[model samples]
Target: MRIALGVSYLGTAYQGWQSQPGGKTVQDRLERALATFADVPTIATLCAGRTDAGVHGLNQVVHFDAPVERAMNSWVRGTNRYLPDDIAVQWALPVPATFHARNSARSRRYAYVLLESPVRPSVETGRVGWVFRPLALEPMQRAAHHLLGEHDFTSFRAAQCQALSPVKHLHRIDIGRRGPYWRFDFEANAFLHHMIRNIMGCLIAVGQGLRPPDWVAAVRDARNREIAAPTFAPDGLYFLGPVYDADLGLPRHTPAFDWLPL
Candidate 1:
């Protein structure tokens, strides 16, 4: 049977989401726990999106096929028993065979939590991105305006990125402020490699008065990676998860979503 799961994890310790040879990746640990719970040799999972090292997942979606029969509730508690504290299965669903974790998604959302303070993040070290310089929200908002809608994000893509197309539809970029913390919400049909992190770099530059709001459009027009700001750190980048059809009966949110700056 085909099964879908809502997963949440702190990516600080794992080497990104995809399985690696050393077996330290999130996919590695997740697959192991799943196989152990199912008493199988392996049960591979496909995630809606893969996050980089040190990145986090508030609600990540993945789907796998099960070889054995088990109650729906057991899929959550039983599989989690073999998983680490940082990794968990929030909910599970029996999905149609045609359902896909990645392709079935309509859009993906991510948020970059940033802090403005002289002292770096101590308690929330790997959880939040720190900017010592106080940022102006207006300029960043102006810069974000140009990023909305469809555009070729070549300048913001990573050199090692394997995505075939540079053109993507950026549905929204919402910048919200709360005290010393800033939350940048990004919603897109899909993203190129390091797209959000790169855009964050440019937004920060404009927010810090290092660049003008129009500079963001200039970078996009240049279609040159070097013209854009460097890719921002992955520390604050969280996979807010993908949106699927309600009829699919998949859980889109987790408890971690409540703890975020959302």
Candidate 2:
């Protein structure tokens, strides 16, 4: 039987989403937990998106072929028993064999939460990116406008990114601020590695008056990574999850979505 799970995790302690030799990734822990629950030597899982170290996942979807039949709820409660406190299985469903967690996704969403204050983050240290300087909403919004459509994002992509193409269709970019907190939302057909973080660095630069709004357009057109701002920290990045067809009957968001400051 093919099974799908909605998992969430605090990525601060993990190496990343993919399995590694040290077995310190979220995938490693999850696969081991699934294996233990099924009484099998191993059970591999494929996730809709891979998050980097220090990034969080609000609802990461994964699918694995089960060797034994079990109730859907059992998969949630059983696998979670062996998982760490910071990681958990939120929901589970039976999917058709033709369904793929990654390829079937229509679009993916991400959010970056930033704390704009002279004081460094205390209670929310690893949960938010910090910027000491005050930010202007107008400049950042204008800069974001340049990235709203399909374009080559080589300037924002990480050098290590293995994506076949740098061209991606950015569906939306929403920038909102509530007091000292700033939230940036991105929806796209897909994102290159460190794409959002790289953009964040550029946006922050414009917000701080270090660069003009038109500089963003120039950077985009240049398609040169060196000319753009440095990649921002991954601490505040969150995979809001992937959007799939409604006919598939998958949950769109998890409860943790409400917890974000946005």
Candidate 3:
């Protein structure tokens, strides 16, 4: 049977979502747990999105073909038993063979949480990004407007990015703040590697009055990675997961979603 799973994890301890030779990645740990639970040598799984080290996932979706029969709830509870405390399987259900965790996704969402203060973060270290200077929301919001719609995002794309194209359709970018916390939400058909982090670096520059809001347009138009701001730290980035058609009967949110600070 083809089974789909909703997974969540604190990425601070792992080497990212993809499996690596060191076996310290989230994929390695998850596949090991699956093998142990199903009494198989291994069960390869594919995720809806891959996050870098220090990033987090509120509802990362994955799917695999089960090697044996088991209740859906058992898949969740049993597999999690072998996993580390920071990673877990939230929910599971049967899906059509045609359903792909990555390809079938209509769009994806991400959020960056930043703490604006002179003092660096302590308790929230590795979970939130920090800015030493005060940031104005209006300038960042105005700078974000230039990123809306389809455009070549090569300026923000990492040199190692393997995406086939530099163009992506950015659906929306919403910036909001409460107290000293700033949240930037991005929805897009897809994102280039390091795209959001690079953009964040520029927005933060604009927010701190280091660059004017209109400067973002020039960077986008330039399409040269050298001209854009440097990539920001990945600590505050969260993969909010993928959106699928309603007919697929997938769960949109998990308890972890509520745990994030608004």
Candidate 4:
């Protein structure tokens, strides 16, 4: 039987989502725990997206095929029992054999946070966001508007990105401010490696008067990585959620939702 698992994890302690040669990873731990529950030595899993080190996921999806003997509820409880506190299995359900956590996803959303106060955040140092300088939210919002559509995001992608092409349809890009923090929300069909972080860095530069608003479009047209800003820290980023089509039987949207202004 095929099963789809919804997972949430604190990526601060692990290397990344994929298993590494000698490093601990969320996948390695998850495979080990799943083995214990399945009573098997090998279990392969696929994720909706690969999050870098120190990044977090509020609702990451993974799919795997295992025997029907393992109940959905038992899989959740059993997996949690063996996994560390930082990672938890939120829910598990039987899925169609054709369902996939990655390929089947319709859209992916991500949020990048920034604290715009002089004092650093103590509570969410590595969890929330942190920025010590005053940021002009209006300009940042304006700059983000230029990115809301299909474009080749080569400038915002890492040089080592393995994606076959830089073309992607960016559905939306939003910027908002709440008291001492600024938030950036993005939705797209898919993302390239370090795409969001690099975009955020460019927008921050625009916010700080370090870059012109037109620079965003210029970079896209150039399709050159050398002209783009540095990638932002992974700590302030989150895999907010993924969107699936109604036919998938999964919820169409995440319940804890807030629609950011476009």
Candidate 5:
């Protein structure tokens, strides 16, 4: 049976989600834990999206076909026992033969939390992105409007990205501010390497009055990565996870959902 797992992790100490040679990634730790719990020599898993180092995952979906049989509850509880404090299996389910953690996802969502204050982050140092300059929400909103729809996002893509197409459909973007903190919510068909972080950099630039709102559109049309702002810090980026159809019987949220902005 194909087992689907909802995972959450603080990527501060890890090298993102994909497994690496050094075994210092979230996938490495997860595979190890799964293998130990199932009494298997190795267990391979695939993620819905690959996050950069220092990024977080709120409810990352993953799937694997295990040779041994185990109860769903045991997969969660037992696997988590072998995992680190910052990483956990939130939920487990037996998915249909066609259900894929990545391919079956209809949409992927992400959120970036920012601290806008004169003082740098203290308690949430590695948890939130910090910008000492005050930001204007109006310009940021104006800039976001231009990015809603299918377009070539090469201007915001990382050079190392292996995506076949630079064009992607950005379904929605919501910029919200509460007190000194700013939250940016995004939903899309998919995102390229550094796509959201690069967009954050441009949005922050426009918000800080360094560039005009139309600058975002100009950069998008330019289709040049060098013309856009630098990629923003990965600290604040969080993979809220993927959305599936109701018939799939997948849980869309984890316990950490309440701790973040709705």
Candidate 6:
């Protein structure tokens, strides 16, 4: 039988979402817990997206197939029993054999956080974002406008990105302010490696008056990473969630909105 699981994790402790040799990872813990509980030698799990180290996820989806006929609640409780406190299984349900966690995802949403304060943030949000000089929110919003449509994000992509093409369609990009902090929201069908953090870093430069609003457009046209701003820290990034078709038996509403800045 095929089962789909909804998961949430604080990524501060793990290397990343994928399994790595000799490195602690979310996948490694999940696989071990599932194997021990299900008594299966091999279990294949698929995630909606891959988040870099120190990045977090509020609603991550994973699917795997097993021969056990246990109830959904059993899967959740059983998995959580052996998993660490940082990783929790929120829900589990039977899914069609054809369902896929990654391929069937229609879109992904992410948020980058920035805190403007002379002092560092408290321990609660310390791992969530950068606490830097006050940034001009209006200029940052205006600069983000340049990235709304489809374009080659070569300037924002990591040099190590293995994606076949740099071209991607950015469905939405919006910047909003709350108090002294700034929030950047983005939605796209797919993202290139380090794309969101790199974009945020460039916008931060613009907000700080180090770069003009037109700098983003110029960098995009130049298609050169050297001319673009540096990539922001991964701590501020969160894999908001993935949008999947309802007909595929996935949850209709993602958990992303719960963490949205009011």
For residue 185, give model 6's deviation from the true position in Å: 1.2
Which scores higher on TM-score, 4 or 5?
5
Query: Which 10-residue window of candidate 1 scores lowest in summed lDDT?
Result: 253-262
lDDT of 1 by residue, 182-207 (tens): 99999999999899999999999999
Best by lDDT: 2
By summed lDDT, the worst window of 10 consecutive residues in model 2 runs over: 173-182
Task: Write down the RMSD of candidate 2 (Cα, Å).
Answer: 0.6
Pitting candidate 3 against candidate 4, the one with the higher TM-score is 3
Q: What is the C-alpha RMSD of each candidate to the true structure, in Å?
A: 0.7, 0.6, 0.7, 2.4, 0.7, 1.7
- Stretches of model 4 off by over 4 angstroms after superposition: 252-262
Candidate 5: stretches off by over 4 Å: none
Angstrom error of the Cα, residue 46, model 5: value is 1.0
Candidate 6 error regions (>4 Å): 252-260
- Those runs of model 2 whose alpha carbons end farther than 4 Å from true positions after fitting are none
Residue 2 alpha-carbon offset, candidate 2, angstroms: 1.1
lDDT of each: 0.94, 0.95, 0.94, 0.84, 0.94, 0.83
Model 3 agreement with the true structure over 1-262: per-residue lDDT tens digits: 9999999999999888999999999989999999999999989999998888778998999999999999999999999999999999999999999999999999999999999999999999998999999998898999999999999999999999999999999999999888898999999999989999999999999999999999999999999999999899999999999999999999989997887778
TM-score of each: 0.99, 0.99, 0.99, 0.94, 0.99, 0.94
What is the per-residue lDDT of model 6 for residues 1-262, given as tens digits with 9 covering 90 to 100? 9898888888888888989996498888888888888988856699988888888877788999976778899999998998999888888988888888888889998887767788777864735576567788778777878888889999999999988999988999877778866678889989999999889889989988999988899988899999998888888787877888877666634555466564
